[model samples]
Target chain A: MINIEDYAERQMRRRGMEITYARMLPVVVRRIADNNGQVLVNSMEFDAYNQYWYLVNAYELPVGTRITSDTHVTLLETHTNDTMEEFSGKIKIELPASFTGNVCQALFYQVLVK
Target chain B: MTGSTRVIHHPIQLIVRQPLTPVNIYTVLPGHIRRVVGVKVVHSVGVHLMSADTYLPAIGYLSLEFNNRSYHMGHVDVSFDNRAEASDAYLDTEIDIIPGSLLSGHYENKVFTGTDYQRADGTITDKWSNYIVTIYLKALSDD
Candidate 1:
C-alpha cells in the first residue's frame, strides 16, 4: 500500500540517499509440506558502491489450521570480505509444515544506493 | 582543498506501512486482515566500499522489534576493500516474521563515510554518519 514518492522521500531524509523509484519483490513458498521441509528458497547478491537494505513483508502468510506457525529465513555470508570488494549475502527460506500451496508470500524492496 | 566532510546523521524512525492509493499508511492491520490466516517476512542488507577509504560505507546496526521481542540483526563493514573491487560484507543474517497478531519492525542503517571527499580529493577524516534506517511492518493488507 506504500507509494513510491513517499517511500523515496523518507529514504532521502533518513538515509541521506535519494531514491528515484522503488518497487516490491515477492518472496513466496509453494507446495510446502506440513512437516519441517527445509527448502532452499531464495538467494541474492549485488555489487554497488552505495549502502542498501531490503524491506520484506509477509503477503500470503504463515497460516494453516492454526492462526500461524513457525518459519525461518536463513541468512548466510556466502562470500567473505576478502573474496570480493563487495558487501553481500545469501538467504534461504524455511517453509513451515503449516504452509502449503503458494498462499504464503512476502513483499520486499530492492534499494539501490548511489 | 581543506576537506569535504560533514557529520552525517539520519536518526530515521521508519514505520513500514501500507499505502492506500498514493499515501502509504502506517503498518496497522485492519479488521479484515486478521480474518485471513497470517503472513511471514524475510530479508537482509549489505554494503561494499569498492573504492576503499575513498567511499567507505558501513551498517552501524539493524534491529527488528516485534511480538514484544527485539532482535538486533548485525553490522556491515566494507571499507578496506580495494577501489573498483568488491568487498563482501554480510550486513543482516536473517529476519523471520510470523503471522497472527499485527507486527512492527525497526531497521537501523547507521553509515560512516566521507560523502564529498572523493569529489574533493579523496583525503578526509573517518567519522560516523547519522543512523539512516528503514522499518516495515505488516503490509499484507495492501494487496
Candidate 2:
C-alpha cells in the first residue's frame, strides 16, 4: 500500500513546498445492490477542502468472495497555471445502521497518512 | 523471499531530474520493493491576466503507461460550470489498475499544453509547454 502522507511530503519537497500540516481522515466505503442481487460499486466524491470522504455501503459482502479490490482513480485539472495541492486521510469501509446481515457487511479498511 | 513478498513503506522516495518545461521531459523511477501499484492524481488550474492583452490559460493531458502500453480502467471525469472563475474551475479523475500481470517496468509519459494570445487585429501567437510526470512500478526482483 502507498503511504499517502509520505508521498505527499516527498512530492512537495521535490517541488520546493514546505510541509505545513498533515492530517488523516477515516475511510468511507459504500455499495448498492438491486433487487436482482447484482452488486454495484459506489462512486465517491472526495472533498479535500472540506476534509471529508463519504460513501453509502448498502450491500453486505461475503467473507471469501471477491467483492472488490483496490480503489481505482482518475484526476482532471480544470486549469493550467495552477499547482496541485496535497492532503491525506484514512479510508474505512463500513455498513449503515439501517442494514444488518452477515452477508451484507461492508468491508472496512484503515487509511493512514504515513 | 520471492519478489511478491517485499513490502513498500510509506512516504515513497521520488527523484525529479532537471528543469521541467513545456518541451523537456522527466522520469519517475520506481524501486523493486512494492507489490501493489496504484495512482491517484488531482489538480485545479485556471487562467489569469494583468490586462486584456496579457492573457494566460493552461491545458494538459495526463495518462498512466507501463512498458509503453497504457492500461485502461474505469475513470471519473468532472468539469466546473463557469470559465471566468479560474480558482473554482475543478475537475477530478481516477483510473483503476490492471489484473495479474505485475506492474514492473519503465513507463513512458508524454504531455503538452498550449496557450494563445490575440490582439484587436486578430493577430495571434500560440505557445505550448511539454509537462509530464512519468512513474515506474515493479516488484522486488530478489527479496
Candidate 3:
C-alpha cells in the first residue's frame, strides 16, 4: 500500500533532506539481513524507523570496496546527494501487525562511491 | 547422410519457478546497537554475460528495515565458479537470491557499509570480488 515515489519523498524528509533528482524511482521491495540475522522486506510506508533498517550490508568493512550501481543503497531516504550528513533524520519505523520480525532490510539505489 | 529421411523439429519449453523469499528480525535494546535477526534467503539464479561492452542487468534489490528506515542491500551473487568459462553473450545478468541469518541486535546501518572491502577502484570489479555468501552472528546476552 505504498507508492515508491512517495516513499522516497517521505524517506528523504525524515532524513532531513529533499529530493533533488531528475527522475523518480519506482517502488521495489528487497530483503536484507538485520542485526538479529533476520530478513525483512523494505516497505516504503515503513521506511521511517531507524530501529529496523539500514542502507548497506557489511556490519563493518575497510576502505576500498567497489561501489557499483548494484552496491549503492538508500536506507531511510530514497536518494542521497553529495553530502553525507543529509542521511540524518529522526523517524522510528513501526512494523505492521502482520510484519512479524525483529529486523529486516529493503532495497533501493544510489551512485556508487569510490 | 542424404536428405532422403524426414527431419523433425521439436520446440523446447521453458519452465520457471518462484525464487525463495527470506525472513528477517529487527530489534534494539536500551543500550545496544540495533541489529537484524532471523534472516533467511536462498542462492540466486545464475547469468552468463559475454562481449566486452559494459552491461547492467535490472534485477530486484534487497533492503533491511532498521530504526524505521528502508536501506538498500546489493544484488544477489551469481556463482561463476560453476561455469567453466564466459560466453560471448553480452547482456545484464539478473539473479534472485535468498539467504538466512540469526541476529541479536548490536549493529548500525552505517556500519554495514563499513565492511572490509578492497578499494582498488571505485567499482567492485572482477579482479577482487568481495561478494559475501555466509554471515556469522554473535548472540547478545539477555539483559
Candidate 4:
C-alpha cells in the first residue's frame, strides 16, 4: 500500500489547501418525520453507536393550533461522539381540540460513513 | 521468460457528495455578513446556497462532529446572503472555513450562530431564516 498519509496530502492539494493529515467523515441526514407518542423521533443510530444521540438545530413548531402544556419539549443526550456523535431527540406539543392531524412532529437523521 | 510488471500510481481525486439532509429556507439568510442558525448540517460546498436568493459567505466554518473520539467541533462564524433579489449564476461563491476548527471524521449536526450576526441592539442570534443550502462533502471513498 502506498500509505494514507500520501493520500491525505493529495486530497489537500487538490482543494488548494496545504498538505495535512485527517480523514473525511461523511455524516448524512437522510430523513425527518413525525411519529406518535408525542415524540419526534429520528432513526439516527447504528450498532456500534449508542441508543441516545445529540440533538442539534432542534426546535419546536406548532403544526396548526397553538399548543399549551407543561410538557415542554426536551432534548435528552443519549450518546456522544463515542461512536461518531449520533443525534436523537423528542418533541412534545399540546395542540388545541380543533387540530386534526399530529399534535407534534420531528425530523430523522440518517448518517452514512464510507 | 518472465513478463515485466507495470507499476501504476492512482492519483488522488476529491469526490464530492450532497448532505444527507435537505437544507430548508429558514437556514438561509439575506445579508453581507450573516451567521446561519437552526439548520442541522456539517459542511457546505462551492458557496452554493441552493437558491437564487441566497449566497454563502467567503469565509465560514461548518462544525458537525469531531474526529478525536473524545470531543466535538464547536461553532465558528460566517455571514449568509439571504437577499430576496440576489442574482443568479453565483455558483462560484465559496465560504472560507478555518482549517484549525475541524478534523477528519468529525460529523456535525446543527449549524448555529454567526460571529458577526448580532441584533441592532448588539445581541447574538443563532438562527437562520429560510436558507435552503446544499452542503457538499469532499472525501476519498470507494466508487
By DockQ, the best candidate is 3
What interface root-mean-square deviation (Å) does model 3 yield? Answer: 9.5
Question: Which model scores highest in TM-score?
Answer: 1
Candidate 3 lDDT, B58-98, residue by residue in tens: 22233333233334332332222223353322223121111
lDDT of 4 at B54: 61
Model 4's CAPRI class? incorrect
Tens digit per residue, CA lDDT, model 1, A20-42 = 54555565544533357554332
Cα error of candidate 1 at position A90, Å? 4.0
What DockQ would you assign to candidate 1?
0.02
- Where is the poorest 10-residue window by lDDT in model 3 chain B? B12-21
Over B1-143, each residue of candidate 1 has an lDDT whose tens digit, in order, gives: 11432222112233211111011112433322212222222112223322234344443323233322222232222132234555332233233333333333323223333444212222333332222123323322322
**Candidate 2 lDDT for residue B2:** 54
How big is the positional error of residue A70 in model 1, measured in Å on the Cα after superposition? 20
Q: What is the C-alpha DockQ of each candidate? A: 0.02, 0.02, 0.06, 0.03
Error of 2 at A68 (Å): 16
Local accuracy of candidate 2 as per-residue lDDT tens digits, B57-131: 322223223221223232222121224554431132222223333232121111121124422222333332222
TM-score, structure 4 vs. true: 0.21
Q: Per-residue alpha-carbon lDDT of model 4 for A32-79, expressed as tens digits? A: 334653434322223323212222222332222221111111222222
Where's the lowest-lDDT run of ten residues in candidate 1 chain A?
Answer: A64-73
Stretches of model 1 off by over 4 angstroms after superposition? A1-5, A32-59, A63-92, B1-143
Docking class for model 3 is: incorrect
